[model samples]
Target: MVDPRRFKSRSAVNAYGGLGIGQSVTNWHVVGRSRASRRGQRAVKRVLFLAGRAAIRGDNALARRYANRLKSGWEDRKAIRDVARRILFVACAMWIRKEVYRDELVSVPSPTR
Candidate 1:
């Protein structure tokens, strides 16, 4: 198990040079756009990205959340980022509780007006 206290919050994780939150678009033209940002911890970011992709490929709360976000018209990268953030929070919680990850614990709420 890991130390949950190592990360104070989701934003802390993102600021630690792990998540790709630092990335930003450099230019946007009528025909095309360019993106650029400060380099984060490549290894951590890659692992997180892969984990998010894997979660999306499986039948779990994260996967359902990703699909829901996509259906709601969220951009692909934005959806992926949110997934990764969720993963970080879940991991921290699991570590703190000394329990295994559970789908039911991460339930996706039904859409309501």
Candidate 2:
């Protein structure tokens, strides 16, 4: 039995699809098309890698904020993952809100060390 009402964040859904969560979606076709275009695939991979690196640094506020959350449990790996998850959530929410990623709102971080 599957819960159709279940809500998953955009990235989570994408990841699930990428991981073969349930039935196959047309995502593979999309990915194949993306990869077929060598330039597009390279650009995408570069962007993803850059974003990942930025998250590890102090420049990305979203990552910093999520790091604070993980501080409660003192698990760096889990914290970084949570931050990545939130980043995807924010991207999805922004798309739904028909707006761009506002650095001002998401940039502010806690005054903790």
lDDT of each: 0.71, 0.48
- Using all chains and alpha carbons, the TM-scores for the candidates as numbered come to 0.72, 0.44
Kindly list the per-residue Cα lDDT of model 1 for residues 1-113, writing each as its tens digit.
23557867767766554554343334652333434224656676667778898999998999998888888777888788778767877887787888998889885744332
TM-score of structure candidate 2: 0.44
User: Can you give the lDDT of residue 79 in candidate 2?
Assistant: 52
Regions of candidate 1 where Cα sits further than 4 Å from its true position: 20-40, 107-113
Candidate 1 TM-score versus the reference:
0.72
> Number of clashes in every candidate structure?
0, 0
Candidate 2 colliding pairs, count = 0
Off by over 4 Å in 2: 1-53, 104-113
lDDT of 1: 0.71
Best model number under TM-score? 1
Please name the candidate that would achieve the greatest lDDT relative to the true structure: 1
